[model samples]
Target: MVLAVRKSVEWGITAAKLFVRRECRILSTLPEKQEYAEKQIERAPSGRKSITKKSILESRHIYPEFLPDPNPNWRNSLREKLEREDMLKRRGQVEIPEFYVGSVLAVTISDPHAQSKTNKFVGICIERKGCGLRADFTLRNVVDHQGVEVRYDLYDPTIQKIQVLRLEKRLDDKLLYLRDSLPEYSTFPFDMDQEILPEGSEVPVNPIQVVLKPKPWVERWERQELKGIANIEEYLTEKNKIKRELRKTPWEKYDLMKQYRKTIPIEDQKEIWTEVYTQLHQLQSAQKKMSRKRVFTSPKSLLA
Candidate 1:
């Protein structure tokens, strides 16, 4: 009976010790101490502020192709993986600047027919379509009273240079209707000088509205509800305007599911950027170093 009583007393002491240890842990995790710990963490050498909304937007611009097609039927993880690999490989070979529809571009490509074995064209981008390896853009310009539109594949290996002479956005996304408009609207000089924007400044959007030529147009411009064209009404008859009004589906704008299906979710975009950011950052750093070297180095003839 004395031995049994000693065992129970030992059990009680062990339980008390566990309770005191837990209490000490709880005290250590109190609100004040927790805040102090967080402060210390924020002040750590490798700590960084949370990613800003601006940074996310900038990533969206710099890595636009990284966002997979929003079409549910077209999405395939393996295909996207292969495409990104190809895109990165191409990027390593050439520098593709961030440009949008209505931005003037100068593209130099190897041409067997040309005497110099190279040809260069400059025009305003009218459309950008397709994705991955198939991505391409159309540039329209008036050369010697003739309208010339050249479509170039973004990943084409023969492209020597793709320079943006004027970097600006348009009020509308696709400027394909520029074809039906007057030639002057799409005209850009071949030797147009680069309009350099101040570093860290926001890209300007050209708000000028284009005037379209008299019908028949390539498409129903009135139905498209284009914001970039100003004189659309002058070309439309009363019946045409009425038809356009009847065709308008204003309720489609409020269709939440449609927008969700057509756009990449913010979470998905963040995850994608996380995977691509490091590799792209490294590539950009290397390009910067190479460019600096080229700028510093001079030809022997120039030195002489």
Candidate 2:
């Protein structure tokens, strides 16, 4: 979906084209603050061994895979501030509808590999995951008797448009189990067109439960503690129990340094939340203004 957008508004066409140029972006924003934790070294009060405060201080910063990915170098604070402002502006220009997992959506991504012109994929949103600038959603739909799922970075320039056919959340964050579930849970019309929820109207929630795969699931099924999966206890084999026990790191609790090596620090959290809250306020104000305009047009739009 290459947007051949030409605008006279960017002083001239060159600036507008430059404005929409594709820029590199990172997938996640975790693991950085983990590297900056202040760790303390232990020693006897006054022993022959002696206590020394070295500048290195044990150098204990390690990362785990499960944590969100890292932010990219090209990721600029000023640019992000501007991007958020633009998203707000775009919402006013076109209604940016609300959506959640289990919502069937028709997402149009700008694929350079696409043949002809527009490249689009329509599927049911199985997973709505990630946060901050990297937040993304996944769509699962079976096409041509084959199952297919695609994940899209919400704010990626590669995304031409996202149209919600059904906007709702599921019982779980990830519906990967839909892979083996019944066809109805994962099926969507191949030629299904987009649906528009009425402007400023309530986006309907679909509380559908999806069935999971049987025993020997791909993920740590027991630890994750999924509800949608039927009779997990029955699936728990003796070997699975041993694997779970072996996988557990009892020392991890006593390991303050280990825990310190795996998370964002207090200062970073303060900075992130400060920006998040400020942005949320801005979004709220914009929504309120949009609501007021709608109410002015029709008092009934707000609610009886």
Candidate 3:
């Protein structure tokens, strides 16, 4: 019994010594491992860093229409899949360039009544709404001193060409307020030249604020908080200001449920973009090649 107890105590001491040695080795290597990790992080390429931070999910801003309606009532997975297929087919047919509400666009559509069987209109995009194939955009321009607005179906078969003369964003998502503002704000020359941005440049935002026309406007501009309008306060009375303040829902921004309802889930968005990214990339490459060819041949043609 004495020998057995002595053996047990010896084993316990041996085990404790082994544990201490193991812990000491780990502690000695910890700084080296940490330094190696820091070096790896520092040496990482920016492209890989960007991939980790911004994946295919960033494509959402470029192709927002590809996302299905977030409304649970309107959501039909099969229908959305079908719509996506149709939208891809239409996109294959038409090279619809990236554009925003404030961008200048020139659209040419097949018109049976037109002398040339095609009609071209140039204007500033005032609004873009809807999802899937039902998506549409409105363009406003002053022609012959009269304000004219044209609404066109984005994926219409009749659309021959969609050109972005100027690709830029406005302060507001929708520029419908331009309709009530000065005609100059909505106007664009029909022969406006395309402003080609350098490759990989971010879309520029126009911060120009518009002056609104006096009362008797189309909509109650005072009720809506418009960042692109400058002279809205001049048109608003004390009562109007009070009503505007009363209508403000400061808590809406903090309402996660409302945001969730308005946008598709990130995981779902990744899946959708993953399926379409390859095709979109191919289309973009083809377009770039064609554009380069055109640029090179144009000068020679002009000289000839």
Candidate 4:
């Protein structure tokens, strides 16, 4: 029994010594591996320093219509080229200033029925969609307690002028929900003064949350998961909330194919912007010059 015990003790000591040697070997190799990793990181290019400027990338937002239809089946290169040529020609004639969904605008259109031979409508932009020549926007307003909406083609020849009274974006891309909320949210004065943003300043986003009315909304607001609405839960019942949860397709956002189909490729966008940037820049410069002249020439009110 003593000899058996001695043999067991010797085996245990040998196992422990092997474990210690293996651990020491791993520890000794770690510093070399870490130094190699550090050298590789130093050799890699700095992404932040090599990145493109925001101004260069903003062309996609500023000239969205220039991008062709994302649907590959509807794309025709020759037709798109012709449409772009015509769109540029129209832009040369009319100065359509930068505006977004929440922006208040005054649109003057030629109308033979009106006494002045033109009619003006001031409203907040609710939606802007379509691509190329088919691009259009909807404006919403409340006039004399009546909610009114007007859709205008971006390249319409009848449009005499489009003045941006309030140049700001909303939290949501489309403000159609405003129709069910309240008329006050869409109302604007006809003689609203223009608000000018400082040069080189980023466009301001309105973070206002809208309160929705009770049930019977045009859309299923609960299922949409809108970010700009505050009181959506007040209108949702337990059953409605259950239905919303069941209808949710959270995985759709992760579908790479769906996203690719919905957006123009970056290479294609770069090519399109390269073709139109010079003309667009020149037009913007001319608009600035004309605006400056108007400001200086306008009669100033004498202070009392």
Candidate 5:
């Protein structure tokens, strides 16, 4: 009977020890499990929030080309994301200035035919078309009594420089009529000096309206409702003038979605500019520093 009692006591002691060991294990793991649970809870909310700046949103208007094409058929959010990444990468390698249709530009391009393996062309920007990677521009100037216009792709790898000699806008979005205009209006000296505007000033709009030569234009100027031509009626026949009045779509200005379809939504624009803002800001800062250094180092007589 005593032996049975001792065995029972020993078994009771072993069970108590096992119970304590299990409790200790649970107690020891409690903090870690709690920590892991808290981490997951914290992480769940992290992915929901993103930061954007008002300045970046406002500044997107200055770089409209950075936004993806807004055509529904051509626009894929995934594709836009990839294209924006590629564009930002390209911008990091080269300097592209803010310019308008009327801005005078000098572009240096790698040319195999040139003796120096490069060629520089200077002219007034008559048009800027397309968007994203396909963005292109046309420069018009009179060379050797003949009109010369060069259309350049903004993102072409062979382009070495794009210097905005005069940063300004024109009355019209396109100056293609300059092709048919008098030679004096389209002519700009190839060696013309860059015109720098005052600091913190808005780009001035050249209010000069061009006068077109008599008939045989690339397009019917009368039918297009162009505002930049002063002598359009001189070239238009009475029948053509009547047709232009009949073709006018006065209601198009009120079509909100039509304009919206041509441009990225404000919300999407905010997101894109936010993503690339830091990189662009850094580049601008570097450029400012370089310009300041040049001003300080340049000879006073030369600067004057």
Candidate 6:
């Protein structure tokens, strides 16, 4: 006869507790103010053990990287609990929204000392860079006869709200070259407001090509993939090909670092995303309640 191993939800939760207990044990073994303790041991050695143990436990909060990747082992229950706490911390402060590159956004960030506690910056997102807490987006707009670009971390503490004024896409991944291009293409009216598209509507396209300035720009325009370059073939010469050869990759030098930064690890994906899914469901429930409240208060609904 063969026997099967039965799994239980209670067991999973228990395993998680044990995991944290083990971490505490490892942390406790670390030298607890050995240098300072040595002097105290010589002076008043009576309650040395008691004071040192208390100090070790009390100072646990100051340990760096207290929040780390779920687990060293093939993740057990404890990892899930830590992940939930992290997600809740993120939720308590800023409300992150669903957004993508090429969307026009008005980001209001808190500036306490300013005349108004909020400062709003409106621009079109040209590109998204990185993932997780490191994720950031680049916003571009023309101001004072010059193009201006600002990169903001998606999860940064300063951002109050991110309103999608216009959700759209461009032909290229990044529109950084727009810096050296004609200001007219990048410019938008300062007073432009959000354009709310109907649900399931198609994303708009910005097919405008911008003209570039004379030589000596911030970047070698040729190195970047730019769609706005109308006369690219005309600009190309023997010099461009020579430059490409000089910049040849020497056997993928960045393979290890690139892999390290990539965020799609299979096991971590499950635990990290678990809390997000729960919070999203909670947000949906709260929105439903607000909708119900509004319907009851409306003058037309009350009359009917």
Write one digit per residue (lDDT tens) for candidate 3, span 1-304.
9999999999868746754553222211011222435445744665776574344655666676888878789888788888988988888999988888888899999999999999999999998878889989999999998999999999999999998878888878888888788887877779777777767776777778998899789898877777899988887889998888999999985554465567776567767777888888788788787766554211111101
- What C-alpha lDDT values do all the predictions have? 0.74, 0.52, 0.76, 0.76, 0.71, 0.56
C-alpha lDDT of residue 82 in model 4: 92
Index of the highest-TM-score prediction: 3
Q: Which tens-of-lDDT digit does each residue in 198-239 have in candidate 5? A: 566666666677889987888887877777789887767889
Task: Score every model by TM-score.
Answer: 0.76, 0.50, 0.80, 0.79, 0.76, 0.57
**Could you tell me which 10 consecutive residues in candidate 6 have the lowest summed lDDT?**
295-304
- How large an RMSD does model 4 have? 16.4
TM value for model 3: 0.80
Going through the candidates in the order shown, the clash numbers are: 0, 0, 0, 0, 0, 2
Output the better candidate (2/5) by TM-score. Answer: 5
State the local distance difference test value for candidate 5. Answer: 0.71
Show the colliding residue pairs in model 4: none
Model 4, span 1-304: residue lDDT tens:
9999999999768745754554222211011222435544643675554333223445667777788888899998888889989999999999988887888899999999999999999999999988899999999989999989999999999999998877777877788899888667777889776766666665667778878878688988777777789889887889998999999999985555465577776566666777787888899999988876653222222110
The C-alpha stretches of model 4 lying farther than 4 A from their native spots are: 1-54, 296-304
Which residue runs does candidate 3 get wrong by more than 4 Å?
1-55, 296-304
- Model 3 lDDT at residue 17: 73
What CA RMSD would you report for each candidate?
A: 16.0, 19.1, 14.7, 16.4, 21.8, 19.8
